[model samples]
Target: MNRLPYATVARCVSSLSRTGLYQGVDLRVLEAFDLDALAHFSGMQPGALCAGACVASQSSPALALTSANLRWCPACMAEGLHAALFQFSPITRCPTHNAPLIQACPHCGKTIPYRLDPAAVATPLACPTCMSPLVADLTILAHAHHIVGP
Candidate 1:
């Protein structure tokens, strides 16, 4: 994705709000494409994509406000995609990969930026601190899976 200017993003958000496209939902959680072209561009059912983006408050415990630094599982990152659920504070582990999500870079101890610029960085998994790949140790993943019990 191209790096969009803040003004452009703001304008898009305002336009969407005016249209009531995202009624009663926080627009911050969605990416620019999701808000603008997801329904038109993707072949997947629009309902599935839309529903997956927002979680229902009644079904789960109240979530903590997302920090500027987001957390992610390195294993999941290796798949070349980031999961939206990783931004939720209550989600500590990757259910599919059985690995704990990491917020800070292991090498430089700096927090990963929540919104990554694909143009500036080769991939989202690259650490802004050490420029190293964000990979979790196998033993650590195994331990997490054992404790979390699938």
Candidate 2:
């Protein structure tokens, strides 16, 4: 959506507000998506995307819910995908060490450590160690229920 009209963005904000989600998100937050800024704003590394953020615009109707430019945060998405995955919004610290974690290749199964400055977003995810489907495409319908099942 190239420069979505103010009305559209407002509608989305209104909807989110009514749902009691993203109540404090400033309108400027949605404005960042104008130039594929979700990648940068989300602080996600290149290539890899967490499951929740993994669902692309073409993958599911869930994205239709946000003005997020169809870009999802893997960490946030993981939480939505599976409650046990992670516990943080805009996760700035490494869930493991409480330090910082970077995106890695799930295929290579290597931890591509990152600093997560919390001040910077849009980090690349190519592993200097190996290749992996970092952002493995998945449909929301497939994961609409439970990633690990009760």
Candidate 3:
């Protein structure tokens, strides 16, 4: 699945564009947003109800937005929006043999393998039994090296 929903990609690009951070060098970081990893980037808990109206109208309760601190942005509403719809660009994964998903369970520190769905990039991948969120140490695509502006 693609990571960094298109919306966030769009927003990141727009944010960079507006802030003048969008240079050729940043494309590498942008390319890192693939359907495989993007679904986990929003930092939002799935299926949680959003309480405001500023959120994108199409967001699902499971895909509600959260502050960088991992708390809900109360001032913002959680309407049904495609998480990817907010990004200005698309996240492309490397064509190399699928990299191993190396995430650890936040609760247990257990290793979790990653898979690139190329779809469902907005959904979280949890432990098969506990459904715990897995923290990953991802390898940024080489192309992404150029996309993240200094």
Candidate 4:
């Protein structure tokens, strides 16, 4: 994968990297990319996708995010989604699905950190260790399009 300016550019809600010691996306850098490009790559609206996260807009908090580990919502994952707010240190719950954010995989009980390489992002919504799904079927994911909606 191309090395983005700051780091891995997690497209929508469900993908990250495979290798090279890089981690999560830096929104300031990502904001530079065309929203159409991002949506074309990830099948989501860039603004709606990141609505839960803090970013570089003068009105928003300045990059107050936690990217070292993967903390997510199972209910949202069940529908094949991950919210950017999960990366916010202050957010311990999923306001959309009303589920607590979790760091460990339910299948293998392993903590899956964000990765941004080809292989990992290729199977973005799966557990790297157990090869189990981090989200439910991708088909189900389509039905949950309202996930990032206002």
Number of the top-ranking candidate, with TM-score as the measure:
4
Model 4: residues with Cα > 4 Å off, grouped in runs? 1-36, 39-64, 142-150
Q: Which scores better on lDDT, 2 or 3?
A: 2
Q: Write the per-residue lDDT of candidate 1 for residues 1-150, one digit (tens) a residue.
A: 112332333344423444343232242244333444444343446576656552433233333444447577776665444566777777788988879988888778888666423322344345756776665442343343354455
Leading candidate by lDDT: 4
TM-scores of the candidates are 0.53, 0.20, 0.19, 0.58
How would you encode candidate 2's per-residue C-alpha lDDT over 19-133 as one tens digit per residue? 3433333221222222234334434443333332323333454433433212224553333322212222344454544544333454565554321111112222233356442
Q: What's the true lDDT of residue 70 in model 3?
A: 20
| lDDT by residue (tens digit), candidate 4, 1-150 | 111211234443233333322443443323434556555655567676455444644244555445546778888777555666687778899998778898888888987765443446555567778888776665564444444444
The lDDT for every candidate, in the order shown, is: 0.51, 0.33, 0.29, 0.57
Judged by TM-score relative to the true structure, which candidate is superior, 1 or 3? 1
Question: Candidate 1, after superposition: displacement of residue 75 in Å?
Answer: 1.8
For all candidates, the clash counts are 0, 6, 50, 6
Candidate 3, lDDT over the whole model: 0.29
- RMSD (Cα, Å) for all candidates, in order, is 10.9, 15.8, 16.9, 7.7
Model 4, residue 142: displacement in angstroms?
Answer: 4.9
Residue-wise C-alpha lDDT for candidate 3, range 35-140, written one tens digit per residue? 2233345444322212211233223332233211121111110211112222222212212323222234446665433222222134343343355533232223
